[model samples]
Target: MSMVGNPVQVGRRPLDVDLIDRARAGDDHAFASLLGPIVASGYRLAGAMLHDRYAAEDVVQEASLKAWRSLRQLRAGAEMRPWFLGIVANECRSVRRTRWWSVLKFPDVESPAMPPDDPHTTFAELRRGIRRLRHRRRLMLVLHWYLDLPMAEIAVITRSSEDAVKSEVSRAMRQLRGLIGVEDA
Candidate 1:
């Protein structure tokens, strides 16, 4: 069953206890309801990490299966966002490990170069900088910036302390800036 649907508000409303109970009782729609908004973030997170739409889709699909299989193991009062996102992140890592070479992006030396200040050029440079980062740092950067997740939440997902998550995000930013180089104003 495809759980795709319009994203609803998240991070605001509390988890629906009724929905969780229904899902745990083997109700597919209840599970889908629980996943509705969270899956959107999972899809985006996978897409940014994998840099391939189809691969990201596959990762999310696999993660959803993993999540469904383990729903019974979810402890009462546990937050679903971090749990599901962690699963998606793990799946992305697995995919990257299995097919590492296919995701690498080399410079298109043969193509005509764009102007230095062009938005496309800047974005391409940013992407290259992100790719050069270590996997963990890259995930931190994407999660904090691209996904707009708080350091506290990222800490939970990464199984690290909040201070560690903050330090990593700061270091990732510095490293990315160094890789991208600074513009003298």
Candidate 2:
């Protein structure tokens, strides 16, 4: 889904703040409720980044499990979205590393047959091109463009300077544009 398609909530009420507070205090139900909104977004981010359903599912699952286990480690008043997404990105890197090791020993399988007119298939090609990028570049591109994360947060997540993040994003976008044949990717 595009950024325009996702709903935005403007302000939080007191109850919502209480829920976050309770969730941080090890309340399972509140944590579950807190996770509800992020689950689909997490899946989308992982799917777009990894370009494989199984890998994306595993990434999200691992991230979610880790988040549940370490909920209390999340400091009070911290923004949950970027923090959780950082976890997902970490899991994605793990999945990519394992896949890279496997691919060293075996070739990747061909795509299953799909109708020529399928837009989904076209999008899959774009995602495949993303997967072809180097790890840091791919992570930078996905987090910046696909997830609409700010450069500061991306730098924190990727453990780079904001200038380095900007440089990688620029380089990745150029490569992606060449692959996708567009001025913008």
Candidate 3:
């Protein structure tokens, strides 16, 4: 059964539960099936965090492998998206730690093109502002704003309290507004 494009309903769907069980039992296809829908989200999160397509791909690969190995540990009724995303976040953090020096180099050719338009320019500026934030703050902002994840889920992924996540997101937004030269009104 195809898992891609399927709604994430954890134990509510018999097929999803079956796939999870088979995946936990070491069925590689089942594992791949379960990951199909959410993997693109993982890639997007990694790309936003790392700011490099190739590095993001590497991070997603590492995270996917980790999820595969730890599939059995996942609770039956729990949502898989947040748990898997947390792994991706951890992998991104590890990559950032190891490749801290790489940030000094010129931008990658694969960087998204920012068209010379009012909205696009503003978005590009905002992206630049986001890249300037501390990594943890950036991750929190991207998870909440870019990925549309809930604050509680972000807290779980970052191992911070929900209040902490809320504060960090607020601080990041204020910093971003300053960087983009937008005055609070």
- Whole-model lDDT per candidate: 0.81, 0.74, 0.81
lDDT of 2 by residue, 1-185 (tens): 22232232211212255665566687889887777777776897789777778878988989989988887766555556666777898888787778574485434465787896788777776766786788778888878887787898788667689999999999988897778666762
All candidates: TM-score: 0.85, 0.70, 0.81
> What shift in Å separates residue 110 of candidate 1 from its native position after superposition?
7.1
Clashes of each: 0, 0, 0
N/CA/C clash count, model 2: 0
- Candidate 2 off by > 4 Å: 1-18, 99-101, 104-125, 178-185
- Residue pairs of candidate 2 with colliding backbone atoms: none
Residue 70, model 1, lDDT: 92
Off by over 4 Å in 3: 1-16, 100-104, 107-117
Of the candidates numbered 2 and 3, which has the greater TM-score value?
3
In candidate 3 the C-alpha lDDT for residue 63 amounts to 95
Task: Please give the RMSD to the true structure for each candidate, in Å.
Answer: 5.4, 7.0, 4.9
Candidate 3, residue 45: how far the Cα is off, in Å: 0.5
Candidate 2 worst ten-residue window by lDDT: 5-14
lDDT string for model 3 (1-185, tens) is: 56543344431233456777778888999888778878998999999997889999999999999999998777756677777888999898888777564566676234366665668677678888888888888899989989998887788778799999999999988988898898976
Candidate 1 colliding pairs: none
